[model samples]
Target chain A: MELICPAGTPAALRSAIEAGADAVYCGFNDETNARNFPGLNFSRDELRKGIAFAHDRGARILVAINTFPRASATALWQRAVDDAVEAGADALIVADIGLMDYVARRHPNQRLHVSVQAAAANPDVIAFYVETFRARRVVLPRVLSVVEIAEIIRETTCETEVFVFGGLCVMAEGRCSLSSYATGKSPNMQGVCSPASHVAYEETAQGTTSRLGGFTINRFAPQEAAGYPTLCKGRFSTALGDGYIFEDPVSLDATTLLRGLQSAGVAALKIEGRQRGRAYIESVVRHFRRALDTLEDGSEADIVSLKPFTEGQASTLGAYRKTWR
Target chain B: MSHSSVASRPLPTIPPLLTLAIRPLPLLPLQLVLGGFLQRILRRNPGLLDRLGEHRYARFGIKPVDLPFAFIVEAAPPRLLVVRELPQGLDARVSTSLANLLALVEGRVDGDALMFSRQLGIEGNMEAVLALRNAIDDAGLDLPGELASLFGPLGEPARRSFELARDRLTGPPEEER
Candidate 1:
């Protein structure tokens, strides 16, 4: 019943709230949250200010302390929960069970939302977080079809949130460790995947070759537009040829599927691009808000305008339609 | 902490561009201010680090062993380069000033864009140079703040110098996080 927006920074948060987000989700600058790039994220004080700003506007703030705990840095993760509670975050979006246990016992008043990183697709796991950790909501992984979603809703008591637009994760959100296998960094441990420090590019006599930790992901000819070399979208040399092997490089555009999501008992829709700028936030949130309003008014929402923002200017229904694959 | 310390305390100069990034800047104190500024900004929006590809660390990845060991970025001149130790290393006399390097770093000058446009004189182990680009992705450049802090008052400028050059040498900043 709510439109959840992503806010990577204070400015982005303001943009989302002003643009009409019902709720906003963000994380601290450290390894506790995903999207852990340098020169980004709020300190504890900034989180307090951001929460205050959102509350003043009648919007909710969701703190994402979603990365799994590293054995050595468990204390930092525990402290992140304490700080978010001090800042008055409306909910704690968590993936690690250990962190969940820490919060449930130490700060019982805090609301806990299961992060998509937890990859809880079945009612059993959602029920696990809800029964054990008392999770109020679960952000479903992007791997299920709408029918599977309705089935999940029928069985679980927790609220549901689906990603409607922006980048799509090829692997299960919370469980992925592909980048770590190639480089030593794990999104779970370090809160970053395909970390910038491990990316390499070359403009040989050939067009351009993009590498992640020395592995060639994609090679753009002199003519093909060069996109950033993320691992999932990289061209791999399988027995199959040199092209995007795991998944194609495309943004998930679900404007046409909102009707199905709402009908399938989804309580909310989320847009995933916290690292985006204010302009990007404003544009995407506004578009989706209007789309949802139109749908509520008994009309089909138009989504043709969402093309430019898509990955490589291409969009796909992505696991939403049972037949997409 | 000026380039004066950098001059006599030689780490073996490969090229003026690869080492002392001196031109015009407020100096070490400025580095602290810059870090504070970044820390302040990051404190509010924590997601700003990974947008597009602007992050400093993505340049250091692990696989495909054929990658460069280091990069020498000069922001004022707008230059990004692959640098590796040569077998017969040159003891080229260092002549450039730090003030010039800082100005180049801040976009007060345009040295980097010039190199990209001209495809100028940058030499190294090209095969190995490929890896440095993905070092951030490789996690090689996971610079510890404490390691950065070891420079003491000189830390900020040193880090700033590394960041500015890295930003320039790397591709344009990624779209917002």
Candidate 2:
């Protein structure tokens, strides 16, 4: 299986490749990508250079122009597609149907991979993308079990990729609007969820309170380590108790399931941290590469050792185990 | 746009290290130990040096403002050295509370948030500081693993003990998804 990695900057792209990534995925510095954090992503020139660097090392580069384009501002998204192609990107990960149609009609020979932002969980939709857009791969959503993923892969001709590590979003990919309800910028349209500009932290009488768009998301005690106040990870007061109702601050780590995933016909394993820095990319990618190597060699490697790098120092198999529901 | 606008403006002067918040006596031993530990780490992980050597951070200072002293990181071999005060003619300075700095090292804190809030302040050459941050991040410094690596063969037991003590001290973690 191919090991796909995330790189928010040129330096991170280099780190990912040096650490043994088979392919590195990134986005433009604009709102065309999901991880549009400040000072993150690549400029056109940087993307060009990054692609060259990765190609020189026998690794591929995928450009994620996954955001849904506004009807009025369609030109920006179109121009991004053009620029990514011009920069010699190995593949384009796209979500919007309009953009897919455009790419299919204009760049017929370019490799297209359906982004998880499309939320196409079933084989029928995956087949639709493959037939209509000639998409070579479909990135499976995080809501499926390994059995379900295997079922879908068996039914569809399109190759399948699964997210095996990094942050866990409780909501269905690409369809979430919670951040827009709070900050008026949707991840699909603006490429930022729970944007940092709307987030603020204050030392309150209760404790250190983290607020997103003036709404209290979480409060940490004096010794507690605080996490980024994403709406999904926020603590809420309900009849049960004051706790994380949507999801807790936990990361997804699926290193132990490499053999099962390979058996399931997973074409690629993706690490989701386009906003993460070099150290994160280096460590996580190197570890996964080693684990995958071990799997290929019929050896065992402990995935539990990765817990320290997890969010809140906790990790889960996530929906891959199918025990949550 | 707002974030970029904030970056375009002139930065403010951050307050000096808060001495009253932390004691001065224990810092010497901690610095010496950390210096030795870092040297060993760099020696074992030569890729870290290869990546860090891409930047020139000679005389750059890392001031955990809540702590009593600062760290002067030399870009060449034997990368980290402790200093009493930030010397003159330095290229850049990264000043943050010890907790926040640790969080940054552990990949838990967002550097942009810390910088925008001035909780983590940076002055002088931003390029050099940016390169330094990238290099350090690629090293993937995990607290328990790092401490465990110090004990060699007893690493697993030491790591488990440290984690158990930490769990006892901090209470149960958030529920797994």
Per-prediction count of colliding residue pairs? 90, 2
Model 1, span B56-129: residue lDDT tens: 23222111112223233322212333334222232111112233223222322222111222211222332222
Task: Write the residue-wise lDDT of candidate 1 on A1-325 in tens digits.
Answer: 6999987667668778887899999999789998886445677887899999999989999999999888987999999999999999999999989999998999988999999999898999999999998889999999999999999999988999999998888787876778988788997767887775676655577766767787888876654543445788887777866667777767788888888889999999999877544445666787899889998998766543655445555678899974544
The whole-model lDDT of each prediction reads 0.64, 0.76
- Chain B TM-score, one value per candidate, order as shown: 0.23, 0.70
Q: Report residue A82 deviation for candidate 2 (angstroms).
A: 0.6
Per-model TM against the reference? 0.67, 0.71
Which 10 consecutive residues of model 2 chain A have the lowest summed lDDT? Answer: A302-311
B132-176 in candidate 2: lDDT tens per residue? Answer: 565555455666677688879998997898667543433222221
User: After best superposition, candidate 1 residue A263: deviation in angstroms?
Assistant: 0.8
Q: In DockQ terms, which candidate is top?
A: 2
* DockQ of the two-chain complex in candidate 1: 0.03
Task: Say which candidate scores most in TM-score.
Answer: 2
